[model samples]
Target: MKRIAIDMDEVMADFTKKHLALFNADYNEAITLEDLQGKKLRDLRPHLVDEIREYLKDPTYFRDLDVMKDAQEVIKELSESFEIYIATAAMHFPSSFTAKYEWLQEHFPFLDDQHFVFCGDKSVIKADYLIDDNVYQLERFTGEGILFTAPHNIHEDRFIRVNSWANVRDYFLK
Candidate 1:
């Protein structure tokens, strides 16, 4: 079976919403999703640069993430036809390793233990297709790259874009 690698953060997990919620709570500001879409937390508000990074260190940050809509359904369906592996760059936060693993187990129990691959560089991962929100990961990948839409990668046109899990299902349906 053709293997497809998926990302966890903004791709399958709702990273933006969680990040923004924390930002809003801490800054005491009401910001729309569009305000920070396609821009990093540091770029949008340099004042919260340290606080933003500090949030990642908190276990609650990774453990309390909301799963992307339709992500579980599409990934489950794709797993039946293709090898589904969760390839994520998760080495930055030492506390995130278990938090992320537990989160996946709770959210995507259909995936096997072998399906999880934690690494900083995705170029080392080999698969037939990679669905990720980070363009740099796609740039270094050898296989087909499917860009999962995220604020930081809105303008990137290097790879086919999947706006949502429905788009992912449609892409492979072709």
Candidate 2:
């Protein structure tokens, strides 16, 4: 069976709002991932990074994360045809990893432990296809890339460009 790697944040789980909320609450300043790209997490004022680390350590934050639209259906359909694996970035804290796994179990009951891969980098994972929101990750994975669109930037290219899970399924069919 073909092995497919899927991203968790933004693609499967909606974490932007929760992340922004926590950042604002901790730093008393509104900060987004887009703003932190060039800047270092340690340099952020009021130590927002510390709070973010704490948030990751707690599994409750994962409970607030919602699955993307039609994600369940697409995942189910794809899993039938391919060896679906949930490949996600590791949490900053060790406990956060466990929380993330638990969160995945609770939210995505269809996924099995063997089908999950928790790692800091996805380039090491072997797969036939990688579906992710981050362009860098898609570029790194040694497989066919399916770029998922986000609010900040919409990547338009020859490779798969999908706004929703329905589009993703249609793209695969074609």
Candidate 3:
């Protein structure tokens, strides 16, 4: 059976939504999703880059992130045809390891714990496919990389893009 390595942040989990909500509340700014199209939070507000990084350092940040729309349903369906694995770059923020794992357990209980890959680099991943929002990570991957659309990668057209879970299903299931 073919294996599919999936990204955790911004792909299966709504990292941007939670991050923006916290940043907006703390900074007293109202930045909408439309404002973030084709750019990252840091790129949009360079002065607040440090503040944004602080949010990521908070251990609770990843604990309650909303699951991406239809991600659970679509991944469950995909699991029937592919070996599913959740690959996350947890080394960037060590505090997020436990929270991310717990978040995955809560939102994606159907996935086995052993399939989780927490590392600093994605190039080490060996799978038939990798679905991620980061273009840099995809560039090094040996298999086909499906870009899971995110604000930061909105303009990137180097890889096959899936705008939503529905698009993912359409691409793989039908």
- Candidate that would win on lDDT: 3
* lDDT computed for candidate 2: 0.76
User: Which of the two, 2 or 3, has more lDDT?
Assistant: 3
Q: Candidate 3: minimum summed lDDT over ten consecutive residues — where? A: 149-158
Order the numbered candidates by TM-score, best leading.
Answer: 3, 1, 2
Q: In model 2, which residue pairs have backbone atoms overlapping below 3 Å?
A: none
Candidate 2 similarity to native, TM-score: 0.77
What value of lDDT does candidate 3 attain over all alpha carbons? 0.93
Model 1 per-residue lDDT tens digits across residues 33-124: 78767778788888778888998898767887899999999889998899999998988886789989999999999899788999988999
Worst 10 residues of 1 by lDDT: 32-41
lDDT of model 1, residue 45: 82
lDDT for 53 (candidate 3): 92
TM-score of each: 0.96, 0.77, 0.98
**Model 1 pairs in collision:** 38-151, 38-152
Off by over 4 Å in 2: 24-54, 57-59, 155-159
True-structure lDDT of candidate 1: 0.89
